[model samples]
Target: EPEVTQTPSHQVTQMGQEVILRCVPISNHLYFYWYRQILGQKVEFLVSFYNNEISEKSEIFDDQFSVERPDGSNFTLKIRSTKLEDSAMYFCASSLLPTGSEAFFGQGTRLTVV
Candidate 1:
């Protein structure tokens, strides 16, 4: 079966640098999303993209973060300016349903900001 793959299971970054976490989503899905979970917080949705443009974004998706589908199979999330508070497990998910679908997640990209 196909699955979403994320690189760098763990990442450590300085407080002001940039970080790009990569993901290869399942081959046949139509909707893609990025969500983050702080060490002790709830999973929060950052943004969702479809049709090569942003379909929806949550408040946490501020100017410092951006996402792109650089090609047909890969999706990427870029943080322009990392902050200590940005340390969290970033998850890439895909689903066939626009909303309320069960999403499958990668093990996760654990970003540690210092």
Candidate 2:
């Protein structure tokens, strides 16, 4: 069995700086997504991608955020300017099934902005 993997398990950045979190999803999955969990909050969806285009995105994925599949095997999420509020654990997930199906998720990239 394969799993989604994210690089830089933990990161600390200064406010206003840029950060790009990287992920490699399960090879057979077709849909990819980015979600975030604040220190003690529930996970929230940020964006979803399918067939190389964005299928859906939440308000959190605003002008300050962007996601891309630069190559066939990797996906990345970038925050143009980090904010203290952006501190959270970001998870990358992928699914072979439909929208609500269970997906494989990465360990998460913890981002702390100060």
Off by over 4 Å in 1: none
For all candidates, the clash counts are 0, 0
The CA-based lDDT of model 2 is what? 0.95
Find the candidate with the highest TM-score and give its number: 2
lDDT of 2 at 64: 97
Compared with the true structure, what per-residue lDDT tens digits does model 1 show for residues 38-108? 99899999999998999999998999999999999999999999999999999999887687777778778
Encode model 2's per-residue lDDT on 24-75: one tens digit a residue. 9999899999999998899999999999889999989999999999999999
TM-scores across all candidates? 0.95, 0.96
lDDT of 2 at 54: 90
Off by over 4 Å in 2: none
For candidate 1, what is the lDDT?
0.92
